[model samples]
Target: MIEIKDLHKSYKMGSNELHVLKGINFNVAEGELVAIMGSSGSGKSTLLNILGMLDEADAGSYTLDGIPIKNLNEKIAARYRNKFLGFIFQSFNLIGYKSALDNVAMPLYYQGVKRAERTEKAMHYLEKVGLANWSDHLPNELSGGQKQRVAIARALASEPKVLLADEPTGALDTKTSYEVMDLIQGINDEGKTILIVTHERDIANMTKRIVNLKDGIIIDDSKVEQVKASANV
Candidate 1:
């Protein structure tokens, strides 16, 4: 579903150029649950940004679903990003004043979905994330786990082709992280492609495959026996 070849990125600081991603060759098949694991400065975040279309690689080819992603006009890039990707972040990027329902419906609102249909779709996803009861609650009223659930619901509301999560469990406790990972596992079981950027070994174990990055290169890529997050929870 996704492909990258010889991906390279670098940034300049005064007169010096610091190369982040030297050369990254990667691929993720549809329905695959993969983790991109790296320590700080490993370029995982840069790769994720490139994949999310928030940043472009200095050199490389990226293809999403079959469309080459490079040099897109801002308008076209925004459209493609909205159409193809859903994001979950370490910090639950929820609006404080918006109710769970409203937050979930926000994407559809941008998609120009009518209020009635948006509400219906948002409610469906809320229920899917087990947040229907808290639809009327604001982010502050919800617990961390609940807030993440709301975020997950909001991400799913758009029905995007891929879910890009950055340290999704970093803010939660072990138990809560397990619960959230369990939810994520269930979603992947249903055949949604997911790529998680995480440094946690246990969290990486929960995924079907692990791609380890160090100094901008993949050091290890292997499929493992998937550990059930529910078992850990």
Candidate 2:
């Protein structure tokens, strides 16, 4: 579903170059749940941004589905991103004034989905996340778990092909972190390709496959068949 080849990105900070991604290579098949694992300053977030189409790789090829994206204009890239991607961030990114339901429906509104239909779908997603009763609550009205759930609902409401999450559980306590991961796993179970970027080993272990990075290049790739069994159990 997604492929990155020979990616290189760097930022000029004063007189020094802050190299972020260095010749990174990876591919995620359709419907797979995978994690990018790394330490601080290891470029996991940079890779996530490139994959999400929010940032460009200075030198590399990114192909989503089958289209090469290294040269897509900003407008075209944005359109493709909105049409096929769902994003969850550590900060939750919900507007303070908007209720969970309304926040979840924002993408649909951008897609020109009729108001009634979008509301119906958003509510259904909220209920799926066990937050139907809290639909009218703003982000501040919910607990950490609920806010993350609302974020998940917002991600899923658009029915995108891939879910890109960066430190999704970073703000939650241990129990709430597990809950959020479970919810993300449930979404992956229904055939969404999931790519998570995290520094936490435990969180990375939850994914079926993991790509460990250092200095931006993948140093190890391992398949955890045991995760499948554990998840089922």
lDDT of model 2 at position 23: 94
Tens digits of per-residue lDDT, candidate 1, 1-233, equal: 99999999999989999999989999999999999999999999999999999999999899999999999988998889889999999999999999999999998998999999999999999999998899999999999999999889888999999999999999999999999999999999999999999999999999999999999999999999999999977
**Which portions of model 1 miss their true places by more than 4 Å?**
none
Kindly list the per-residue Cα lDDT of model 2 for residues 5-40, writing each as its tens digit: 889999999999998898988888998999889898
In model 2, pairs of residues that clash are none
For each candidate in turn, the TM-score is 0.99, 0.95
Model 2 / residue 207 / CA error / Å: 0.7
Estimate the lDDT of model 1. 0.96
For candidate 1, the per-residue lDDT at 187 reads: 96
Q: Pick the candidate with the highest lDDT.
A: 1
Error (Å) of candidate 1 at residue 176 is 0.3
Candidate 2 contains a number of clashing pairs equal to 0
